[model samples]
Target: MTRISRILDADSYKASHFLQYPPGTEFVSSYIESRGGAFAQSLFFGLQIYLKDVLTQPITRADIDEAEEMLLAHGEPFNRAGWDHVLNAHGGHMPVRIEAVREGSVLPTGNALVQIVNTDPRVPWIVSYLETALLRAVWYPTTVATRSWHLKKIIDAAWSETSDAPQERLVFALHDFGARGASSSESASIGGLAHLVNFRGTDTLAALATARRVYHEPMAGFSIPAAEHSTITSWGREREADAYANMLRNFGGPGKVVAVVSDSYDVYRATAEIWGESLASQVRAMGGTLVVRPDSGDPRTTPVEIVGILAEKFGVRTNSKGFRVLPDCVRVIQGDGVDEDSIAAILDNLRAKGFAADNIAFGMGGALLQKLDRDTLKFAMKTNAIRVDGEWIDVFKQPIDDPGKASKKGRLALVLRDGAPRTIRAEERHEGEENLLGEVFVDGRLTRDERLEDIRRRSWR
Candidate 1:
């Protein structure tokens, strides 16, 4: 989390020690669930790197002792045995197996994206205990990844209607501005990389570090030299013309693109007078596009109006699709109030204004990362089946109040049905059924190392 909050955060916090789940329970099969209908697909599991950054500290004897000591200090209840198995190889070598769809795969609602089980008798409550930390790992990134994925589909659809290179532009269309807006640096890193699973443009530098350290992608994301309001307004709001000239002088050049925030003072005047009339010829001659950012005004109206303003000053070319696109030297970025709905609204507005989707891009902050929670898809991990004594018993919940809260039953396997994914009880599986959920994490080792590139490729598929 943050400086002070890090002291209060740990993986052990998410561990469940309910009376229903006792130490004698030999086998506990807990599966991740996404209730049903959601804003995006119910869940897109970003389970790969959760342990890497989110729940970083693993259990140790000293940690256990310290937690017990703190419990003593606070006169609160504590379970030392809960941390014992993880500290003592609770599941041992043949510990639990975690099966899930691929890291970047889009999972539809009402299926278990992740099914975890600690099969060893030594650690009965390991999976349930790990739930505290592990569920947060899956849900947070999954929510962000699914949200970004849905937004990309929307952005791609809009571009496809008006732009020739829809695929090429869609990936670079949305940039991450959520680093400062996030609750913590780690939140930024996790959610930023989740967004990158669908897009390349980002300003969250911490995500690059996470990709390098956890996912093993040293150069995972890319960003252009961009300016904020402080950089422009610092040159004196009265001297707005000089500020725009300075942007072109320093950051603007052939094959070198830079986005300048123009809403600091008189955005319309800056666009019409400074950018268009004064610097338009220099921008055309000096090479690469000058991406103007209108950081204020209605997202539905701002982008279209800016496109019209830029087109008048810099000139526009009619693409074969019959919509006007900005010349190679100029473009627009509608950053303020950019979210999924506003993104759709702005694109539809621009197309109505006879401008190609290629004329503008977007940047999002808090909405891209911190705005989500575990309940965004009603994510939960519940005991599906357990072995109390020697016999394996099928366990489930069928609450009459809310059927949505009902849990799955029996040993589960993620199998593909005619090329699409669905969960199956292993007992009822056909002879040649292909289970898509592979063992990514086992015991204390990451058995499967999914490259970000492979995940990206699969996401497109």
Candidate 2:
């Protein structure tokens, strides 16, 4: 049994969720009743198989009855004749053998990792409707999850030096713009959450909420103080200063303020002069620290200079335990256009200037998520080859020499080989197969219901 099954008993599992259906039952029935024929027979067979597990449950009966009553009361026309015929059709008439590796496994592009076999010759037409969407739903999440895992490695490495300070070390924040109606918002949200197991910083509110609900990230990316007032007039209002003050007044201090973006007008002058005294004093007085953010210009020079100024003028006072006051006094966050190389440079510069590594937070946006070369990550699907016209023709994309879009074909099995998981193609038919995709739902019931935390833990692993 999968980990998902251990928590929920068998009976409780199957009564919750519904699986995807091709063309959907309502459409299928309408088409068949309005224009009755062999197409109707196919629709009938599909619905029966689709609802086999559903009709067995009392809950489903109640729902169906309720829906029927509503429809009848409203005089809504539904083809009950076509619906009942399809509902009562032969269960084994159209068999679609779907074979896929476990959903979380990493896959390559143009690979026939998933195979859908239409047992009945007449059901081939339905493949076009389901194939594309199904493949994408599975493939993109896995890809994003894999990418997030890779990012975890980088963050883990960078934060290693501050192991003594567990809270200070290893912060993971994700800003998934892909959720704002991106072509693959669902994939992006799932994939983004899979990788954001550590730290907290993101603009995607829904993704953040999901991550917290499912993953339990400590700090949330609430609001970043912007210097909007700096550009209010021709001279631009000292928006950065005003914004910081407003935040301080409302939030009571910078304890909850993770980071503040200060460079809306002039980064250098702002760091040295503007709000430096007043803001820093407020944060320090309140027993909180200010994280000054520079969203533009050369980070290599900006953070180094800002840290230097804060330390020089702030009086290097030691606490009761004798830790340097300035190092913990404030932190510098660099955002705009930051990449791995640029981040590395900023870190190196800070270290050389006696700035604590943990005192610098990297606010990575497009560079971390969007700028990655899609070519580096391979994701694809393929259909299983079946006997056609008495010829053993392999229906698969031939492997390409290109590293980015290589394809793996044939009826494959993913097994743990030599203690590490690997994929193996089945040479011939075998009985009692261990299907990677199990019956998540049976008879209109959910076989497994997992908490968001559980899913996040699985993704982290």
Candidate topping TM-score: 1
TM-score result, candidate 1: 0.93
lDDT of 2 by residue, 13-51 (tens): 122211232232211100001011111110000111122
Q: For model 1, state the Cα shift of residue 386 in Å.
A: 0.3
Best-matching candidate per lDDT: 1
TM-score of each: 0.93, 0.62
Q: lDDT value for candidate 1?
A: 0.78
What's the lDDT for residue 240 in model 1?
A: 81
